[model samples]
Target: MASATLFHDVQQILTAEHPDPFRVLGMHTVSLGGELRLVVRTFQPGATAVSVTDEEGAEVAVMECGHEAGFFEAILPRGTSAFPYQLQVTWPEAGEPALMGDAFAFGPQIGEFDLYLMAEGTHLRLWDVLGAHPMTIDGVQGVHFGVWAPGARRVSVVGEFNLWDGRRHPMRLHPAQGVWEIFIPGVQDESLYRYEILPHQGSAFLKSDPLAFTAEVRPATASKVADLTKYEWNDAEWMRSRQEGDWCNRPMSIYEVHPGSWKRVPGEDDRPLTWREMAVDLVDYVADMGFTHVEFLPVMEHPYDPSWGYQVTGYFAPTSRFGGPDDFRYLVDALHQRGIGVILDWVPAHFPKDAFALRRFDGSALYEHADPRQGEHPEWGTLIFNFGRNEVRNFLISNALFWLDEYHADGLRVDAVASMLYLDYSRGPGQWVPNQYGGRENLEAVAFLQQLNTTVRDRHPGALMIAEESTAWPGVTQLAHLGGLGFHLKWNMGWMHDNLSFMSEQAIHRKYHFNLLTFSLMYAFSEKYVLPLSHDEVVHLKGSLMGKMPGDAWQKAANLRLMLGMMWGHPGKKLLFMGGEIGQWGEWNENRSLDWHLLADPLNAGVQRWMRDLNALYKREPAFWETDFSHEGFEWVDFRDVEQSVLSFVRRGGESGHELLFVCNFTPVPRYAYHVGAPSAGRWREVLNSDAEPYGGSNVGNGGVTETVPLAVHGREQALPLTLPPLGILILQRED
Candidate 1:
């Protein structure tokens, strides 16, 4: 080689501006005189001397410093083919010499098929290809790091091993896939890392791995390399049955929890419970409460505690606040083993503007829209995802599958769906861009959601894709092939709003607001629904469920019992927030425990008891859930008793004529001899009475049973005269 060209190469390496370091730095066969020889080259920033050694620890040759900034090179003896080698270096003041493998010597670790699919944005198992994976290549074990930074001029894997220097480990770019990757030998598990991206047009910065499986705790934003395959899962039985079973007709009573506040270490400054602690405490609590499933608020890693994990930074990582990835896996496995399903709140709607996260990643609007009108969420001060971009869509869709496949989550309760559905959501005029067809609907987002649901369900049968959509977007829970959004269930936000509004009013005003109680029936069967009294209703000073009622303390408790009874009897699946069962008086606070001391009072304990009993009855009674989504399962015995603030309905299970009559009295005034139509003319037993003394209610109800007289009422063949308690709900089943 010529001296002038070698000197220029050395100058480029020193300046960290060389785009292709592999060609000049690694072992290469070059022509010397008339013979081909092996030349090994490397750049160590602070080394004074370097030597090359063969696989047998024999010193092959002493390397000469080609540049003052630590460029080293050595020529092997003639007639020798390339062999495995390592570099031994001595620093100016180090106690011992260091030996390490050449990072640039290894070829690209990502396969061609993976690169092709990644570029096409259809790599469903992107987690396998885009994160720090510990692997052994050519009998040498190391960590292979890969990240997509199409807009970056150069990208490097920075971590403690490299002194966080971008020039130390500049990645080899696969321009076909826009992914930069390198295999650093000797790098192993639990290594802290981030990508130092040099953008084509902006300043260089560091960003966390979007596909990290576990992350460091907040206030420290570094991605941790984890081996996720080591966990021994014990939910195989549950998984196999889940795929083959029908979940639609099943009774689903979900207990929504924010685990951080569900319980805390007593006298430990209210420290949140860890995943191991929750596996012991929270799992048993949910099981004992008779809930069929447990839904967690977003468990993904986030920066601000106040966001409660809604604004995600690490989409594939379980937050380290509780424990490692294995700890979360144990939590899910424990729940499934105990016959409880797990659902996660997934947020693909938006992400926070944390400088170290996805915002302006690669110094460009890569994951979000380039324009503020399409990218920014004004109300949340976050950034909306660019649903139109293929890679961005793949990121979200793959993330959804990751939770379901990796964590064994039974379902996803997609949050902020309404915002994603409409382009102008919470926006004033002229603040949003229109789609190609120029409608208010976000056409791209709609397509993304449809594809997401279809792919997830196709890959994992019986896995629920629920939408928390509040708007009247048609066919939210219908099949996508039939022009619907393809969700298995959707939260009945309208029902929650109207029911809570009606129950919050005074007794006299409730009669005037009777429509609020009956209005939801008009659309109850329109889609599969879950009546959610969720965390949203109890947070942000909206007040607790008990606090929302209008009355004295006793009336408040009684009103809460009636509300829960009515909710259970309603023609929809049920979901209640963590503290709702115990009549928590204060709004939910993420930082504090759930006022567990309230259970010491009988009134509060009674509410808890009522919830348990209600869950049992809901699960055991086919009439309540066996045909929930069909109109045939429900019949309005009478809903026109507005003058008395009363409602009556008959719920039927199957062709066997299994039926239960539900009668609710919203007023606090007891009524004697209230005649309600019965489905048949026989003995009707009062199976459940919410007004019973055990439930903190005035014990006025039918004494176990009532006889149906052969008198016509409400188009039925018989009528039963019954005593109705104040603020009461009664479930009566015929004993035929």
Candidate 2:
């Protein structure tokens, strides 16, 4: 070695240890014989000859091989100023010479302001600055790659273009912000890439980009460069109206669906439906059913199909199993055009411990906590996110906003929120650690949820933030500024559990468990609520909703109609799982399609017809949904009929003149001439009856109209004689 400094720099570049390769490997100025000269250095490890070509393709200097390891250099004359050049290299036994652009020729692409904001953890649009973004820089077109791996000794962009060689494109590190960025001249969309991170200790490993907009199909993990701006959206009207007001008082009947199993190709190996296919089929099917929205169980990318999208790997990219990222955008746009909103199931509670993903991301606990008590979820065999870390918080919050802003999602139903809120969740006394205040609540997670809700509402007003929180958390739907979690709606888990429990008993035994059906009203108005008969209820051998009813097949179908009617009549939004509408007998299995053949039978078809009518009636009549979150919207007419196993209630619409009365009989025995209180002395119309013949029920009900008499009953000045059908619910409205 002629110079010690040159020898050290060459070794570092060859060993892939140089944190910043631009200063040492690119063109530099040096002093020779008391005169300044231009020196060009290149590290083509396998090249036999290398030359520096000028801007006009003229050879300026033929580089001399300085080391047996393909280190080449050339120094120009003192009078020869620095000029734009390219590299022309010849490989041993190669047929022709190759010309290539120097990756280090470009300067830093990220702005300084973004770096500062990222360091402060306030960069809301961090996605724009990080990840693989294709752009043109200084008459050169390529991809700008950025990543956060503060703990790594060195990081390089490796892909098929670079022959998976780390020495080809070592990134420049921003030490203060812990970000590594570089402009790779000529990398474009559809290029598969991953980060080759050299940890400060141990062996190096490959990682898929955390902010990857799209990923290759599973069994082959690599990030694909996708241009999100190319897709043209057509949901202007929907977006404009969505931002105008809150959706609390609106009709929200959500049909929860798992896309992969919802529908499959007939006789074609059960192939899942593509996003484009779903757009054409699912959007219209849900529209025809009169559902206002469709809530998909986590559609984020995951390696295991059995996880049912719950264990997420690619948070930003929709699962490639359906289609490309643009395909997903098309699905959203199509649904929006049909006046149906989309709500995605978001899994921020925990993530699976996949080796190629976020686990030990930087050879350290970068995204999760170091201690098992704080980081690991024993029940799920997954890792819990470190909510207290600024970078981790930034990652999750940005992901939440990404779905809303980029994908045009109308709402987020955060899954397993109870797991995130409590430290002792599913754990024994000695196995968990409490917060600093010695409480069971995870304070950091609580703060993170508050921040997540606040940011989503402040930025995207009228967007819903729903929590699948099971416990009795205080004020889950209240505003954050008023000292609450700031969710727009919380799942009424208690109601679902109690209702199913009581409905499963025999008709004669239901009277003893009568309170199970009416106990939810005790605190129904405590938070904005959604009565969810979700996927969880039909899985894990819990049996289908129809199968849970204790009766013959005919009675079971009638009971399902009764349950659906009761859900709509209750003072809350409604969410029904996919197979529940058609009396599906089998429990939910994510591997296969729902039993679409069930609809061929009149018993099942009638249940489906009943569900469709329920949605139509629920949306049209404001009394069913207008004041769902307030105590004033509901009043108990009669709940003391324990021996008969019957109940009655009144629901009020926003208008003073709009009101409805509901009478329910839990048993399979008709009650004739049942007296129920009415609000006004007028004719009442029997608007909806679960015992109708069309809904797989025996025709047992009063005629369409009943006259109310001016007789005082149950604090109401009017009373009406009603015919309560067996295992049925009756909805009566005032005749105009």
lDDT of 2 by residue, 271-320 (tens): 98999999999999999999999999998889898898999988888999
Candidate lDDT values, in order: 0.90, 0.90
Q: What TM value does model 1 have?
A: 0.98
Cα displacement (angstroms), candidate 1, residue 554, comes to 1.2
**Which segments of candidate 2 are over 4 A away from where they belong?**
54-58, 77-80, 91-94
RMSD of 1: 1.3
- Candidate 1 structure quality by residue, lDDT tens digits, 121-187: 7889999988999988887788999998888888888998888888778889888668889999888
**Looking at model 2, which ten-residue stretch has the lowest summed lDDT?**
98-107
Q: Which residue pairs clash in candidate 2?
A: none
lDDT of 1 at 600: 93
Clashes of each: 0, 0
In terms of lDDT, model 1 sits at 0.90
After superposing candidate 1, which stretches have Cα over 4 Å from the reference? 1-3
